[model samples]
Target chain A: MTLHRIRGGPRLSVDNDRCERFGTCEWEAPGLFELGRDGRLRYRRRVSDEDAERAAAAARCCPMQAIVVRGVPG
Target chain B: MSDGDRIVIAGAGVAGLRAAERLRELGFDGELVLIGDEPRRPYHRPSVSKQLITGAARPVDMTLKSYTELDARWRLGTRATHLDTTQHVVHLPGGEELWYDGLVVATGVVPRHLPGSPRHDPRVRVLRTAEDAAAVRRALAASNKAAVVIGGGLIGCEFAASMRQMGRDVTLVGHARAPLYRFGPRIAASVTELHRQHRAGLAMNTAVRHWISTKETFGLHLTNNQLVVASCVVLAIGSVPAVDWLRGSGLTLDDGVLCEPTLFATGAEDVVVAGDVARWPNLRFDDEPRRVEHWLNAVESGRAAAENLLAGRGQARPFTPLPRAWSSLYEVRLQTIGLPALAEDTVRLADGVTGFVRAGELVGACGWDRPKAMLYWTAELDRRLPAPATTPAPARWSGPEARPAVGTAP
Candidate 1:
């Protein structure tokens, strides 16, 4: 339920406990999320408005349903 | 097309739900309807075997958030009985026919049952739906005897891991020499070793010879002359696509609904297929049409099918996706890209990395506890296989045009 806000864009968060590190989000939104070489998940706290659709697609495509992106206009 | 056109999506699983969402996201503001046999809304199915079994995640937690914003009619608990492609109608069990300008087939798959299994027996269970997981949990909690899980695929292995975490004595039985045999024998051995370290019994390369159920205990006699006794038996044997209703619908049906490269049903422009029920030539690896039953494939194909449906044949792009899947066994995480099952040889690249080769070419790669390696290999595969050529324009279909010619035979 922790929400991380971007400076002037949408907020985003990922529930680490539920995330299996599938790297699917990384595939959908490469600029926002990355699975590091050490087998860890690294993601930005927020994304710009232009990338909001990609972030939403990543959240929707996450197999674990762990990612949450808020303030993205439909 | 006008906003008054109707689009009916059969099957409300992840694929069907994704298609519906993509249709809306792509600005297809029209009449939308989703029909599914499951009584509940689409939920995350992968959790049923792991988190749901362990009570770590509830049914509500698995609900897809995208479903809330869908402005569509949902016909849950309703089975699609027949399809008349000529008249563009989907027949329901109660003689209700739904006509649509476009149709999406995403009925998904059903778990295959073990032959001669006692249907009325409470000890026997199969984990596919939420109810199945709950039943299995209840059965495990009610018994002190060891639990026998038949089949060593991803679902069975995951269930075994969850049961072990719950402090249950579990035995995993598989006909292959090791668990996850499709991922190559090395990764399978590592998984087998992980199970061994957890003190779970491994029954590999064996088939059940006899089913012995008495008043108190359930037992499985192996072909190797060993008896595995347990209070509960879970059959995790694979699944078959739920395409029974599409048999006489004039759509080519092999193991699944055969589709062209664009995911449109062969010889049909207005109908498209997606999810576990779609068999198409990936074109990323080969032209052989195959069905991929994975979580990512469902999400990817569902969106692709939806986009192609709107693009029509003239503007549609070929649907070519590299198949990917993953499984968790205890502390080990196995991830794979491309078709490992089609590999003729396997080469161990690193301590936890294995590369699959077919005809001296890398067809797939897998990583055990090495997510970074999987990502690297995924990029390599993407570079090796270029994106398929743009779909050629077939006959157009809209107002008065005849149905488009089927692109290519699957």
Candidate 2:
């Protein structure tokens, strides 16, 4: 098995301190990061490849530079 | 990801990231190096009010994308100093230079610093960066008596609402009459009403001419010869293209980079500029090169530049003009579609909902808790509706205003 996962993704994280919560990432990636009840943020449970790209778009579109994406464990 | 064909990008904002994503989608499998001066991943700006100021969110959780997933060399915290576009090389601030076959500069705009104020003043701030938002958020926690917002545009209005919610006495001072009067009177009214409803001070048609500095207090001198005192000041004045580094570079700069129709530098070259930094003329808007500093425009423009870089002239689709942007402030959802910047008239379809329209079609609209009305009006905008009896100024198109001798929906 290839140790490194391909371009597929199932993970996302954000540096909350740096996040202005601008919603650009959420606009770009709706299925990934859900603004919780607190209006803060949390990742959805399942993130497929297609939705992952959208999430990536939102993450890239974020102006505050506050997300970190991890693939399979390593 | 190999630098299969090394593509150089400057300014690590939304434009750069959107372009990178488009390049990958277009199957440009070469090396992608994204250079940014800010040493962080891209995040959002809209949240500075609702989440960060309310302490509902944090910056780390708000990036547009995580750095690990991007298939690019992250040259973060490095400024691209010079562009020898002719030599196909970009110089960095650290004395290192990199060669490029294609370049996209999404440098974005810099927040206009408060004029005549000491830069090191702890109470002074601008809400552009995540850090800036956090500073403003933190400042409001202690003392938010009267905040002197230097601009009365969308950002200032949105902040006024957020501060009012946070119990901060806010004063929005702008040089324009009623602020954004050109954006449509209804929108300006809606914004003004929101501030008034919250009891915040609205100082439209007013200017922060200068500041009188003292040991602990700084007084803002207004053009009306009035002095307003505040615990802190948040300057939301307009921004300018961050083109200082490109001064000596031969690239054209009429306001921002005067890009050709294809979003390229005036002279023929591999470098391309997008987002708020490039003055991209819209064909639909009479070739007026507008540098819209909105999120949607930034993403759309960035994607177009990336696609062109990947496919050159052959395979890429034409960059259609972006749809006008929308926003949410003070529980009001404001949307602008097409080009309202060139509109000569406005029509309010729903009660309190206003749109700039002309000749029986819709162009730009600002709705107050009525997105459904905006959508219906948007669908009926281009179609031929019966003409209004009046001059079509401030009349509904599909609801109640379109009836004259016929008594149809306006």
Candidate 3:
């Protein structure tokens, strides 16, 4: 799993083995997911509570279900 | 359940490859073989139109996984010529025969081009393969001339958007006034607006009567006598199933290989089908069999088919997924759920989501740039929809076991 952190934000987990770089996550949550050059998907593990909805949408929209979110409190 | 059991999967696309992987994941320690006509490994076909064409992704980047990762025999660049159902064998073009206890037909679909058109000509291109996309990219980069897209479907509209973004003059021609005619007038109008926003020319409600080609340039003479001259021509018309190989196999072949509710091929207990080539009755739409040519359906179908292959007929659950597909063009993204093709009436909701109705019921929904609405509607539709009949005998694979409940199937 590829992990990235933003210190005081929700942690994001991306299973590199399952990620196919379709870039659907990028559209759902632009602040968290980025489609880099050569179609590499880069993401920040930590996201603010306000952006939690977008983060969850990214996870749901992913065809491969490669994205997993953690530490988002209600 | 023995290790000696062998499974042969025809086609190395997402459907075929995933079925093999799922079988392994499900503790199937059997011999697995994957065959594909394409030389390269299984890649994300969706990206070939959007990211790959725009130079945002490389050919190698489109691959779903490293071809070397699968624990199966690879037979790339080889066509499965025929299926000998009586002998449980798949005959290849070179007299190579593969015998298996289980079989999966996942040959997918082949791009449909203009009939009688000179496809070998340098100016013509199709975006089905990586090579085809690369060739178009090279052609677009080399010349500053206007490009013509011969279809008004999703693919054609997408290519027009991509090319126009690359600073090329693009003209999109289609028979309908709007690009996506099946999505009703409002959605089509929105798509028309999307292309118009990019200043791409649209010759809608017209047909290409003939092609005029010379050594220097090519032209498409429209029915209205408006000749469209261009350097490159892309046939984004659509595709047909790659089931020509299974013609005499005795399986029901309509638009694709027809399968039972459990994803098994008709009349064949050991044979299953997946991906764009498998036409099974989706439990959501009242048992109306459909063949969805989207990325997610292919993967999920393969995953379900793997379980069905192991569980056999009655023991396996049905494959009834809520159909959803998304496509992005320029800055706008369209997320659709349920059956967009069967929608007869559409109502534009206040939240930018369109409710697609058929027979006085909301059968589907599409959202344009409405991410939040897409999520809500997806869940709403899944809950509100009627459950597919459990008592009626299936078209095939009808057994003694009781049908499973909705959402619990597969």
User: Which candidate has the top score in DockQ?
Assistant: 1
For residues B169-240, could you state the per-residue lDDT of candidate 2 as single tens digits?
878888887755667877777677777777988777778778776655568889898888776778888798
Q: For every model shown, what is its TM-score relative to the native structure?
A: 0.92, 0.77, 0.82
Q: What local lDDT score does residue B128 receive in model 3, on the 0 to 100 scale?
A: 88
Q: Against the unseen true structure, what C-alpha lDDT does each candidate score?
A: 0.84, 0.67, 0.78
Q: Candidate 1 lDDT, tens digit per residue, B1-410?
A: 22236799999999999999877766565678999898888899989998899999888889887822578899999999988898889999878999988899999889998888885798899889988988988888777899999998999899889989989899998899998887888888888889999988989999898889887788899988889988799999999999889878989999899998889998666889999999999888878999999988998899899888877755677788887788777887778888888889999877788999999988888999787677777888888866776655432223223222222111
Clashing pairs in 1: none
Off by over 4 Å in 1: A1-7, B1-4, B391-410
Evaluate residue B376 in candidate 1 and report its C-alpha lDDT on the 0 to 100 scale. Answer: 73
> B296-343, model 3: which lDDT tens digit per residue?
788778877977886676666688878778777787777788887787
Ordered list by TM-score, greatest first: 1, 3, 2
Collision pairs in model 3: A4-A45
- The per-residue C-alpha lDDT of model 2 at residue B296 equals 74
Which candidate has the top score in lDDT? 1
Tell me how many clashing residue pairs each candidate has. 0, 44, 1
Q: After superposition, how far is residue B290 of candidate 2 from its true place, in Å?
A: 1.8
